[model samples]
Target: MTRRSTGATTMPPAPTIPKIPPAEVLGRLAALQTLPTPALKEMWRQLFGREPLIFNRPYLQSRLAYRIQELAYGGLKPETRARLEALGEQLDGGNVVLRRIRADSRPLPGTRLVREYDGIQHVVTVRADDFEFEGRPYRSLSAIARHITGTRWNGWTFFGLKGRPEA
Candidate 1:
């Protein structure tokens, strides 16, 4: 009986990144800020392993350059990172905060919200701290909605201010 052995192959070692001079690093970072939005986004993906949440060109460029510098010069100290995390948690309630649906939905003061319900046209004037409907000040749009419909309703929904809920 005879036995045969397969040959073993050696893999090449990973390439090493040369230490760039500080001046060159600064120059590179400066150059990054002039890149277009799409290019910056590509760089962001390469550096961060994910797409950027912001689409603004200047902001993207700045953040990507900062990230590049951070990687080369080392990141924040553990204590600084922990402090930042704690601050972020406090601001964000320890979870991902959803964008407000009504962030820009509210009408400016003196602007009017009009709705035709039950063959009657209702007009609501946006005020500094409250809404005015029929010369009556109301704290909430829901209150106005209740006044109009005699039932509990989301004022924004009733006035066609809110978009359809995502399924």
Candidate 2:
């Protein structure tokens, strides 16, 4: 075709959408699923104040869920991350994690604490002499601390409020 005096342009063809390999898709799902659902759910609640679930109303919720999950799994938050570091100083080789608030306040079952350290937050639950959620075994809080942070804690406690530790 010959060039015209007008500045009109032709539209480009639509971009093709590539299908994801089933193996790759399954691999990612497996990794995410490796972590306990309760822990993942707790992380979601702390970060987004909601459960880690794929919403399917209009498909928008699933998108949000993926974003939330991505943030939680990336790394610890700066606020809580520092706290975890400070716990080491106070405990002198003891693990000091930020404990969650309360049982009912907990986001899910089998979740003990949602502590923040070093600008990062973690949702953890431990039953004495048993293994932690991710297979980290602990005989005591100190052991749990070591297993979780590889250090000590000076300001570690269970989740509670001003009037209730068991609340």
Candidate 3:
């Protein structure tokens, strides 16, 4: 009898590459927004193999992260890693989510509007309880900002941590 034959052909899956840390991913999201053309996104896919994770979109955060792991970070340049780390601080400042462990509400607990006051970017911090600017009564900085600038900015405006003026 002829030798028994079994037909089977298979190729191995691609090697599992490391995931791009979420912080770096956020930095990429922020950096891509700075670009003006689609070319940047194309370059990103070619370099990193997927799109960046940006919130406020139709998809859930979990799904976005899963996709990032499934597709991105295969052949990314090591140089881009450092650049993204720096960018994360700039874009994702809201990453400062910690339990309440503070003594004084330094600079008051409110939004700090970055405005050009006296030819300089002066930070105006406000609190909801007793917010006043030059004898003008306002509820929050958001109110004053809207009154003066006529636009809404991100509400989570923070100057720095408690007692860290230089920060």
Candidate 4:
């Protein structure tokens, strides 16, 4: 410490942080199990060019490392992204109303639902617009279930297509 012109004690400015190469940063990120939260946040800012929405340690480290490697190497192509999105949409039934209404019980066409009741096997094939059972076309599975069980039953539940009744 030294005396300033005003006769007050002063200290030198903090040293600047050196910029590390992306490759080195990636290597460190790979090797380190944990990093300081502040450092991780800073890396997130540098790699993403924006502040992260999450501050969880593992999430921050993983996302920061991925961004660093992605920048140093390359990111997914537009075609790949589009393909992934299409696949997601297909899994989602390609429509919000269908997804919400059908839930997990909507099997793709050509799928088969097999069940055994009273020592007899039952097979139901999913069709594009209807279902096929015993060489006959049926519109609703509930009708098939009612015919088979001789009582009212939820077709999806009877065929194990649904886990629980929808609210």
* TM-score of each model, paired residue for residue: 0.41, 0.24, 0.24, 0.46
Candidate 2, run of 10 with poorest lDDT: 158-167
lDDT of each: 0.75, 0.47, 0.48, 0.76
RMSD of each: 10.4, 19.6, 13.7, 11.3
Model 4: per-residue lDDT, tens digit, 26-86? Answer: 5676653566788888867766667889999888877766766676657799999999779
Off by over 4 Å in 3: 1-106, 109-114, 117-128, 158-167
Q: What is the C-alpha lDDT profile of model 2 across 100-127, one tens digit per residue?
A: 3322222333547666656667555744
What candidate 1 gets wrong by more than 4 Å, as runs, is 1-51, 54-105, 163-167
Tens digits of per-residue lDDT for model 1, 1-167: 88676777677755443444555677778878677778788777777767789898878877867777776787799999999778766644566442132233556568898999999999999876789999889988889999989999988888887864311
Between candidates 1 and 2, which one is better according to TM-score? 1
Instruction: Give the number of the best model, judged by lDDT.
Output: 4
Best-to-worst ranking by TM-score: 4, 1, 3, 2
Better of 3 and 4 by TM-score: 4
For model 1, the run of ten residues with the poorest summed lDDT: 96-105
Model 2 compared with the native: what TM-score? 0.24
